[model samples]
Target: MPTSRSSSSIWTYLFLLGEPEQQQRFFKELHFISIVTLSFGVASWLVTVALMQHRHALDTQSASLALVGMVAGVTITALGKSLLAIVVSGSASVLFVTYGFQVLIAATDDPSFWVLPLGVLITLTIAPLFSGIAWYLAVSLCVWVMLGWEQFPAHPQQADQYWPMLAVVVSMLIGLSLNVYFLVLRIHNYQAQRELATMAYTDSLTGLNNRRRFTQSARQLHRSALAPAYFLMIDIDDFKQINDEHGHDVGDEVLRKTAEVIAGIAGEHLCGRLGGEEFAVIYQGDKHGACLLATQLIETVEAAFAGERKVSISIGVAELVKGTDLAHSYRRADASLYLAKKNGKNRYELAAS
Candidate 1:
């Protein structure tokens, strides 16, 4: 089942969505978040003055710049590219957070320097999740440097200012460091999971869909089929002989080559390996088209070998009728497969029943 945007662990869900559709959904989540962040920027400016003890209103110019940057961020996101939005958002956030922190300091009393570190915490919490590693480091470094600029122009009069700015730099570094560390681990884990999924659903020898995936795909295809759907069961002829005469290594290569041949013909259709030298194809088309495909499979494999080793396949195609599951259609194809072997090998048998 697909996850909703309101999923509890939305960040993890977005990263897990590597498929085309899921990726699109992930960006939609980001799009919504960007809107929220932009709204918050506007609202914060309207209320920043009220939060001050002296009732000193913050710099309207800096607030305006921040709002303008966020509007640009939201507008760029409307173009529908999430990565671009991240860059734009990160750039805008840096601009706003830097100036916003200054305005916050201006509105504060003696411990005004402490407000900058708090701003660093807020930026670290909000910024890194939307962007990649490069953008994260870039934005975090910019925030630290912008705050730490006062460190270079050290004077006895301004010595106290260095302490809080140093605190802000340390805060930014630690927060961003933790973010990078966890992101690396999560990405590695996700890649491992994806690889395992591929291994589980694919045949190791042929790189074709395995039996489990084949049955699953066939069931799905059957449901969506408008006309007629066929399950073609294919078996390599004298496969045991090849293994016995040339060893399993050559036999494995033959199976891989055979899978490629079938896959080449299957094209937009689905094919799978049913263990050993047996394979299957789920096709949607007319009986004549299915028969033509089976014929092509037979002729192509028989003529594929020019070396001392030659291979052939016997196919059994069963047209799935209404209210019939893959198991029922498979039984008919199995019977047809037996008939093909019982009569003559290197042929295809169509089960009309």
Candidate 2:
């Protein structure tokens, strides 16, 4: 459906990465998790600072930074600036990790803050391709920094610290693998939605817009139309007889071939198969152009199947009026279609204004 090469490439990239509608969905998810995680971090830090104020002086500046960053990130996400939201929130997360690591190291020489980067695993799962990779690397860098900083500054020769560090490394590996698995699942779900939408909106037999899709689109076009518009109601002449005489297989071939011909000619317009042996096209042009198109459809279809079997079509033409609904225009076209068949099939009749 993408007409240009750049657009097609962009669609392919989006498909490969994850949800095509990634911006809004990613921002919303990020906003939600950032709110929850950052709120908890700020509250827990505030409580810790309060309880430890008398015993040991603790810095509350990082907690204040986390609160402010969360607000800014939520506002950016609401504005649909997904990349910026990630950057803001990620900066806050970095502050939390670095500050928490410092506090834990100074007070108890504990490396428990190693698990903090695991919070960023959710971002890896939800972010777009480049962003996901960036988060993964950022989290990895944070973990490595904490491990190296803790070793170099204190307990560099402590053999018992190696086991806990090893465990943290293994956990990061597992979390990264799981993030990849969930990202694949997310892409599969988005593709499934697209396939289901196509099945619902497309005609399986002719590959045209089904009646439901056609009516919805036609009504919207009618309401917004600025140019002169016309509707053509078309039917295969004596289609039942063709099916009865030559088997249904032959009838199906005729329908498919006819639809192809109509689509080729009216491909630029709103062409669709209304029902069995009935097709319609909504053309944007004057009366003369509409009549000429109908004539072309009759001539082309006849010439396409001339050697195999005689196939012809009757078309009804009705100009769309600004004040009238599409249904009224359809009825007018249907009336003219009847007359075209009555006066002798394979002809077109234009409905009077």
lDDT of 2: 0.69
Best by TM-score: 2
Q: What CA root-mean-square deviation does each model show from the true structure?
A: 8.2, 5.0
TM per prediction = 0.70, 0.79
Which has the greatest lDDT?
Answer: 1
What does the lDDT read for residue 222 in candidate 2?
Answer: 91
Provide backbone clash counts, one per model.
Answer: 0, 0
Instruction: List lDDT for all candidates, in order.
Output: 0.71, 0.69
| Candidate 1: worst-modelled 10 consecutive residues by lDDT | 13-22
lDDT of 1 at 198: 92
The CA-based lDDT of model 1 is what? 0.71
